[model samples]
Target: MLIVGLTGNIGSGKSSVARLLKEMGARVIDTDQVAREVVAPGTPGLQQIIDHFGTGVLNADGALDRPKMAQIVFNDTNALKRLNSIVHPAIRAQLLKAIADYRDNPDAPLMVIEAPLLIETQLFKLVDQVWMVTVDAKTQIQRVIKRDAVTAEQVSSRLAAQMPQEDKLPYAQRVIDNSGTPEATLQQVRQIWSDAIDRSQAQAE
Candidate 1:
């Protein structure tokens, strides 16, 4: 199976694109979703997180308090890295298992791994190709502000903490401009899905 990295700056509709890929019959392993699943209240991953950040990041049900934890990392770089350190390895291991299972089953020719921090975590190196979904800074900040219901400065600060889309573009095998309508974005994804199937078949031969 051919593995591709799908990433984008925050608020770039990267999840939407991933869903489109799923609709195209590509097995997409969303690392963010896996991160949450691996750390459910009683899991070893969740226990490690509580040991690191304390009980403050938990809800009444002992589940993760996303906003509280997000606030902690959004402002502190080292804290963010530490959190990723704890979470990312587990996510990568889980994804590798998923990939192995997919290949063993031979269900599809291609698979996508969706990670918001693909570039930041250096996980891009694991993929056969990278596809970056990007938009200009002005659009990025505005979209994030509107979507997250935060101030421009807050959005800017969060965006600043991540590796910029500009820096990631050169690393991408293809770029998907996400500053358009949902229909338009899906159109691009559909084309890529068909193309990837062909590429995967060639690689298998």
Candidate 2:
């Protein structure tokens, strides 16, 4: 399988690219969704988090209070590291299992693991290639503020917590510019999808 690690900075439209890939028949594994599942109520992942960060991170509905947890860790590097220590291993195991399941599926020529922290968390090591989605900083900030309904300061803080987009560029084998309209972005995705299929078929031969 041609396993691609799909990643981008906040508001760079990584999910949009993943969606387009899914529409084109690639099996896409979204790590963010997997992360939430691992920490859902009654899971060992949730229990580990509660044990470390306390019950304040839980909602009244017994689900994870994600925003609350974000507030607690976003500014604190040690706290963030601690949380990752608890969560990333569980996520990695699940990702490996998903990849294995899809590896033999002839229908899925491409497997995209969509992770915002693909490089930071070293998940890129598991993929055959890295496809990064990028947008200008101004557009990125505007998109994030609008999508998240957060103040500029809050968005800046979240951005600061992540590795800068420039630093990640060197690690990417392909970069998808997402600063244009949805149609433009879709065109880029289609081109990449076509090339990826050719590469996969060549390797199989």
lDDT tens digits, residue span 50-153, model 1: 99999999999999998899989977989988888888888888887887787688676668899898888888877889998987778878888888899998
Q: Write the per-residue lDDT of candidate 2 for residues 1-205, one digit (tens) a residue.
A: 6999999999999999999999899888999899999999999999999999999999999999999999899779999999999899999999999888887564688889999999999999999999999999899999999998999998898898789999999999999999989999999999999998998889889
After superposition, the stretches of candidate 2 with alpha carbons farther than 4 Å from their true spots are none
Superposed by TM-score, candidate 2 places the C-alpha of residue 189 at a distance from the truth, in angstroms, of 1.0
Candidate with the greatest TM-score versus the true structure = 2
State the local distance difference test value for candidate 2: 0.93
Per-candidate local distance difference test: 0.85, 0.93
